[model samples]
Target: MSIINPALERPELIAYFLGANNYSWLHFRNGEKKLLSKPISYLEGRLPGFIRVHKTALINPDYVQSLHRPLRQKMAGKIQLQSGETFPVSRRRWNQVAQSLGEHLSPGNNEEPLQESVYLDDARPTSEQSNLGRSVASLFLVTSDEQNAFLARQVITKNWPDYRVETIPKSIHLPELLDDLAQSELPVLVFLDARSDTLERLQTLQRLKNDPRLCRVPVVLLALPTDKSVIEGYERQANSVITMKEGDMAFAQVIDRICQFWLKIAELPAHC
Candidate 1:
C-alpha cells in the first residue's frame, strides 16, 4: 500500500483489491476505491485463495459470488461479487478458474439479468477523473446493513444538525483513513455494529487494535447485551462498548447516551 507520506507501510490498510490498467492495483480502502502501486501478480502470490479470474484481475474468493459462463461461449464470462459488482473473466483462463472454483458455484442457476455491460459506474474511479472520497466521508457511517446505516444516520443527524452523514461500505476498514485524519489533526469516531458489520470487519478490528498508528482513534462497538463476542470486543481493545438493550425506547436511550458521552462529556484525545 502507498502512503502519501512514506513513513508508514500499511498493507492492511486496503479492504479489497483488483488490478487497474496503469501498472497499479485498485485498492478499496474503507470502501472507497483508490489506485495503489502494486502489481496484480504480486497480490495473487500474497493473498491465499485469491483466484485469477482475468489476465488483469485477481479476486479474493471470500468475496466471489459467481463466475457466470456466458451464453455465447466466444466471449468471456463475468465474475459477480456479493457487493453486486461484476468483472469479466478472461476467456483464456476460464477453464482453469472454473476448475479451481469447483462445482455449485459456476453456471449460475439463478441467472440474474445482466446489465448493459459488466463495468459499473463505481469502478471508473481513478482511471477516469479525480475523486474526493475522504471529504465525502468526513461525517460518514461505515456499514453494510442498509437499515442500520439509515437508522444511525437518522438519529445522528437529527440530534447533530450541523453534521451530514455518509453511509459507507464497511469493507473499507483499516489505518489509511485514520492516518489521514491524524495528519489533518482531526479526530474521528467510528461505530462498528458487532453483529451487522461485514465478515471482513472482525479481521479489520483485530488489525486496528494491533496497529499503533490508530491507537488514539475512538472505536465504539454497538452490540446487544447478550452478544458473546462483546467480551472479545473489549479484548480487541475497542475504546468504548455500548450495550444495545431491547425495545425502541431502550434503543433511543442508548443512542442518546452514546452521543452525550462521546460528543459532550468525555475528553477525547487532542488530534489538533
Candidate 2:
C-alpha cells in the first residue's frame, strides 16, 4: 500500500520504512524521512515484516541489525536498523522484541519448542520507592526469572501506572507479600508463574485463596500449556489459569494477554 505525502506531493511504498512512533517515519533508499499519520498499532496489525517493539514504535524488522540491552537508567533496550537509526524497546516489550529478532534472524532454529515465560520483567523504576506507599491497587508479579519480571512490570505499569508491584520469585515470599498488601488497604492481584514447580505453586495458590484477608483478591496463574493443573486451578480457587505458551513471541504475548484480561476486561475488587 501507498500514501501521498501532501507536504512534498510524493507517494512512497511502505518498504522504505525504518520505524514508527505511533506515526511511522519512512526513509527513502536515498535517505529522506517522511512521516505517515497512521498509528503504530494499526500498522502492526496490517503491515507484514514489521514488529511493534514499543507502545509507540513499530519497526520494520527487515531493517533491524542489532540491539543493545538497557543502559543504567533506561527502561528498555535499544534497536538499531540497518540504516543506523535506533529505537527504544520499551522495558515491558524487550523480551518480546528479543524473541522477534531471534525468530526473524533464525527462522529455522527458532522452531525449537517454546518455553514457559521463564523470562521476567526487569525495567520497573526502582528509584521511585514512593509507589509502594500508595493505597491504590497493587500487582504482585510473582516470577523466578529477572527478564520476565522486568518485561511484566512494563506491561502492567503502562496500563496501570499507579499500580505498584511485588516481584515474588520465591513461594516463601507470598505469605509476607500478601500480608503486607492486606494491611495497606489496597486491592491486590497476584500473577503467579508456576512453570518451575506445579505442586508447590498449587499449594501456594490454595494457601492464598484460603486466607480470609486475601480471599477476595484475584490470582492469575501462569502454567504450561500441557499442565493438567489448568483444569484444577478454578477448584483451587484461582481466578484464572493462563497457559504460558512457548516461542520468540511467548514472553510479550503472555504479558499482553495478562494485562488484557486482568487489567482491561476483568472487574477486580476496589484495589484494581
Candidate 3:
C-alpha cells in the first residue's frame, strides 16, 4: 500500500498515478497530489495491483467506487473512484481492466438508466422496446476553441449519460471523419462551431454533406444569432442551427434541448 519516493526517501500511500510525458502525479487518499520525479511506467513495475486503465492513468482497486460502461462500444468506459475522480478506460485495455475489476464493479448499474422524460412513448411494441432505452450515439463537436469543447462535453454528459461527446479541433480532415465513422458500429452526430469561423465551418459542413458515407449523419451548426450565419449554415446543408446564449447556464440548456430532440425524439441512420 505504500511505496518509498526515490527522491524523498519516504514511504507514501498513493490513491492513483496520473502521467504526463516523463513526470507522474501521485494522488493520495487525503486529496493531496504530489509531482513525482518518475514516469508512470516506473510505478507500474514497482506497485502491485494498480490497474492501468489508460496509458496515462494507473488506479488502485481499493479506491475504486464504480465502473461506467456505455451501452455501445464506440465510446470508452470510465472508472470512478471514491474520491470523485474518474479515469477513461481505453478500448484496447477495456477487456483486461474489466476482468481485473470484476469483483469491485457495482451491480445493476453498469448501464445507468437514462433520465426519464415526460414525453417518452410507452406504446411501442415489445420488438421495438429494446431501442427505446438510452442512446448509443456519439456526438462530434468540431471546434478549435478549448472552452467550447469543454462546455459542450459538460452539457452533453450531464444531459445524456450514455452518449459520448468527442471534440474534433479545427483543421479536421472531413474524409478522416468519414473513414472513422464508417468503421464504427454505432452512429455519430456532428456539431460544427460557426460562431467565429462561420465560413470555414460552413465549408466543412458542405463537405460533410457531399460525402456519401457521412451525408446521412445529422450535422448541427452552433452559431451566433445572426441571420446571415443561420442562412449560410442552411445553404451548406446543416440539419439545424442553434444560436449561442448569453450565459453558460443558458447555453448548457440549449445543448440539453438538442440532446433531447436528437438522441431522444429523432431516429438516426443505423450507420454514420
RMSD, every candidate, angstroms: 14.1, 19.4, 11.1
Q: List model 1 lDDT by residue over 43-89, tens digit each.
A: 66666566776556666665667766643322345667767766665
lDDT of each residue in 99-198, candidate 2, tens digit only: 7778555453232222111111334445345554434455666666777777767666665576655464555335433454324443457777877767
What ranges in model 3 sit over 4 Å off?
Answer: 1-136, 183-187, 245-249
Where model 1 places Cα greater than 4 Å from the true spot, the runs are: 1-41, 44-140, 162-164, 171-182, 185-187, 197-199, 245-253
Query: Any residue pairs clashing in model 3, and if so which?
Result: none
Question: Distance (Å) between predicted and true CA of 205, model 3?
Answer: 0.2
TM-score of each: 0.48, 0.48, 0.48
How far out, in Å, is residue 239 in model 3?
0.6
lDDT of 2 at 227: 51
Q: List model 3 lDDT by residue over 1-272, tens digit each.
A: 23335422322356788775588888877887878778889888877578987767788887888866633433456667888765656656666777788776667534442221111111222222344455544567766666656676777766676666666555234433344333453336777777776777887788778878777889889888888878888898889999874334565566678878988899887772
Number of backbone-clashing residue pairs for each candidate, in the order shown: 2, 12, 0
Q: Ten-residue segment with the worst summed lDDT in candidate 1?
A: 119-128
For candidate 1, what's the RMSD? Answer: 14.1
Clashing pairs in model 1?
30-172, 31-172
- Top candidate by lDDT: 3
Rank by lDDT (best first): 3, 2, 1
Quantify all predictions' global Cα lDDT against the true fold.
0.53, 0.59, 0.65
